[model samples]
Target: MQRTPNWSLQQLPDMDMGQFRQWQALLEERTGVCVSDQRKTFLQTSLCARMREQQMDDYQTYYDYVTQGPLGAIEWSALIERLTVRETSFMRHRASFDCVARYLHERLSQPGRQTPLQLWSVGCASGEEAYSLAIVVEQALIDTGSSKRDYGIWATDISLQALEQGRAAHYPTGRLGGLTQAERNTWLTDTPDGRHAVLPSLRERVCFSRMNILELAQAPLRDLDIIFCQNLLIYFRRWRRRDLLNLLAKRLAPGGMLVVGLGEIVDWNNPLLERVPDDRVQAYVRRDSSESLE
Candidate 1:
């Protein structure tokens, strides 16, 4: 009798287009996930590695494993963790922060206009963007003796794992370069291991959550403020982008600011937002008022 040899998933054939489409649909349905054709390479590498780890010869077996309940949930969780890109570093864009600094200066310089300084660091991957916002807010406070004012910051992302890392608020040495000399002196301590630690003071100011923009229709955010929903809409289908923009309009305070990534579009003539001075930044001021939300 001939013996049948067992092969790991890596030894199996490449994913056929049909298998890819099925997996894509199932993933989107599972989490409103959307992957561009450009990311096919990323999908293959991550999924295949997990399949091979199970000693499965093909995707069907791997798919079965994930659909098998509790154990499957664990596998799927791991898969999602690997698939998502958590690429971020401090102060990735100097221009945006500069804008923020200028805006806060104007606000704080005026009397009777200061209250709890609220800002949203939307898509704050790995905590850097959130920290950056904290720094900006802090500088404004110090300059105006407004440090005693409470700050409301909500940093949210679709990946729970990414949010976990952000909550930790520690970074390797290279990531520290994103901070300026004065910022480092105030908010960070150099670790012996060539890493930098974000002081608890700065970290505590930010509230982190696992939130999908699509599911944030009920997020308890309202009134006049600043929103930094940056660099996150690149993956959405066109229709979804419009849906998100409309939703954002409702949340923005009248004369409040909405800052989108360079990749985002608000169709400035869309009747909801008036374009700010800088066209490329996609900054807009809301036309809605608190009376409308009520």
Candidate 2:
């Protein structure tokens, strides 16, 4: 009998269209992320990277392994961390933050408004967006002479590892591209090894947790003052995007602000929400009961 070869060290075979569709369907069913046909290589690479670690060779074997049950559920969690796109930085979109600042400034100017502003950073990977919001809110309060008003950020993502990183609140200098020298000095603490950590004041204001936007119906978040859901809907189908926006709209308090990526959506009509027209940013402001859509 011939000796069997060790298949684990062998390179992955070219993924066929059927296999690609299988994996894509699995991802979409579980996570609502629709992988395009062109992203076959991306899916293969992500699957194969994990497979190599487990010493599993064929995509079929890996597929079986990932769909097996309680074990599969555990494995699936690990896989998504590697698969999901987490490329984000501090203030990835300046216009959205500027819009947020304006909203907060208006609220701060209101008379007898004591409620601490509640904000949610949906799909917040590694915490930069959340921390940036904190910085923006801090600056906004100061700029509007309402320093006494309080606010907090609920930063959530599907990846537990990312959430842990968010909780740690440390970031490399390279990721601080959007921060100005003054903002950096005021909001971040320098470490000896060259990384910057968020200041305690800012860190304390952000709460990081693992959350899946697909399961928002069960989520504890409600009556949020602002919801920032940018750069995330692009992976979802149009109907799912509308579903998510509708769910997010329900979570917003009256007069709340919802900021999404520009051009990610168009004509998402909701009677209670009106789009804030800006040349650089796309946003919606929730209306009071009297302003319901016709």
Candidate 3:
């Protein structure tokens, strides 16, 4: 193990190629996130941040500490939070939520649907997308005269820190940029400190959980009506991207929808699903038996 003198957070030593490869492989194996060579500095910086917190200097030592035993699992959790990007905003992807609203409007309008609408927000960083989804669905039900239609969201992310933030359901004022004044008034209450917190009623509708997308096969809660997974596939390899989609497709209920970022995948075809017609929305719908594309 190579040792180094005391170093400040801003003065991180360069990571050697071997060390980089080790980390890249570890990240991919654990979370399915492919860290390219171009991202070597990013990985180094993230690693250094955690190392500094633990007063650990050598990369190999830090690696061993994070991989050795039970405590290693805890360290891994802390490290993964720093490794994963959590940049998100409420209603950041309007088209996808709009598509969901339209679909739910049509579904709630029909009779004989007795179960509550089920939704899942994969890689739901900081709860914005999940809460945004709740607002959209709630609004759609109101517009369709089905305001009492039951619905809930399962927001999952690989970062426990992010999940904790999501469960807090608090946001700064400008963070809700895409939301209208009316929506803010209806769903959020301004804190004494000038921040905004989601109303308890809205917060109660969402359950946040820590989930790694790579563990899709072992994930609970199937037969979902909507699964919104956006801006996540880019971190994974192409083949793994398809594999994830196949896994996600299995979780969808009949006529359920799967939404991804535009251009994240190319030429991916699943016979059991059909692309949503709206050009503005990057989504697909699970095809039920006897259902044909119009």
Candidate of highest lDDT: 3
Residue 30 of model 2 has an lDDT of 84
List all candidate RMSDs to the true structure: 3.6, 3.0, 2.9
| lDDT digits (tens) for residues 1-294 of candidate 1 | 122234442343478888788788767766666876777777777786666566665676777778788999888877877766567777777677777777778767777774677788877878888898888888888887874757878898877788888888878867764678888889888888777888888888999987767686787887647888777876666677777776777776666677777656544344667776864466777765433653
Clashing pairs in 3: none
lDDT of each: 0.74, 0.87, 0.88
lDDT-based ranking: 3, 2, 1
Query: All candidates' TM-scores?
Result: 0.86, 0.94, 0.94
Q: Point out where model 3 deviates above 4 Å.
A: 1-6, 290-294
Models sorted by TM-score, best on top = 3, 2, 1
Comparing 1 with 3 on TM-score, the higher-scoring candidate is 3
User: 192-228, model 3: which lDDT tens digit per residue?
Assistant: 9889999888899999998889888899778899999
